[model samples]
Target: MTFSIPNLLSLFRLATAPLLALVFLVPENQNIANIAATALFLLAASTDFWDGFIARRINQSTSLGALLDLLADKLLIVTALLLLLDAERAPVGACIFIVGRELLMSALREWVAQNGKSSTVRVIAVGKWKTGLQMTAVPFLFYAGDLWALNTLAVGVWLLWAAAALSVWSMLSYCLALWRNE
Candidate 1:
């Protein structure tokens, strides 16, 4: 349970999750809140990459750190998605699929861990792609505005659907791999 730098970064991301919702509390300053939430989400998402990279690079990858990192990623992502859903920036169908897949995967991982088969359900390429797409889409959704000639909300919705598709693919892939290993 040593507090490594990477673990601290994860904690920072976890702490930032609730802050995103707080920004939306000020409906009078919608534009400013949107910008602030987007910035916070981007910063938190960047830490997800950095924490893992630093952990591996520095040879400080501990079980606790891994747990912290996973928790942080889930919390931040779910919070952002929920916020986007509430703001009507993300589609209901996409949110349901994404969040449902996440919960299912989390439970499956726990079952595998309890059975001492955790290696059977390791994170796969599709899962990484899903995370990447989600991370990219979330900030856009949070901003929910136009950037010069680009409509970010449209792009975000497209990317969110893609991420949701990837989530289902990744979940099925993991399940198949686990079943085969079992």
Candidate 2:
């Protein structure tokens, strides 16, 4: 596997996932922990875009890089969601919806692949918006306990619900497209 700068960055972000979780587990350093976690999360999320952009620009896109990018995104988001769930900032229903969507989508994608359908699942625009909403909300919720001045956590919860709604809509759109193709 050829290692490029962007791929290396993606790997670095993946490495930070566990550290972010560790930050949340420490009670005494909760505030600093939250800040650090937020920074790491944002950095990781940004790399999602950067890696893809760089790979496409330099014609360095490889199967491994694409897989690593997807894995990193999922890992970062799932890690943040679990942390939010632990903090009780993210509602149980929202967490369930998010996790459920991921599982169902994975299964559907696998089934499609097995059937010799298109291997590439294009990330739709709405899906991008959903991801943006999720990334923004999850961190705010994570840092909510630290900054009490504003109702950031509540806002994050609302955003989470919006993300869930968008996820459902996008999933339906994808399914419809597949159905139409079949």
Candidate topping lDDT: 1
Cα RMSDs of all predictions?
A: 0.9, 1.9
Worst 10 residues of 1 by lDDT: 19-28
Q: List clash counts for every candidate, in order.
A: 0, 0
| lDDT, each prediction | 0.91, 0.81
- Summed over model 1, clashes come to 0
In candidate 1, what are the lDDT values of residues 1-182, reduced to their tens digit? 68888999999999998888898656578899989898888998999999999999999999899889889989998999888888889999998999999899999989999999989888788999999999999999988899999999999999999999999999999999999998
Candidate 2 lDDT tens digits, 1-182: 67897788679778878988887787577778777777778877788888889999989988788768767777788888998888788988887887777777778778887887754456789888888888888878877753657777888899999988888888888788788878
Q: What's the lDDT of the predicted structure labeled candidate 2? A: 0.81
Q: Top model by TM-score, which number?
A: 1
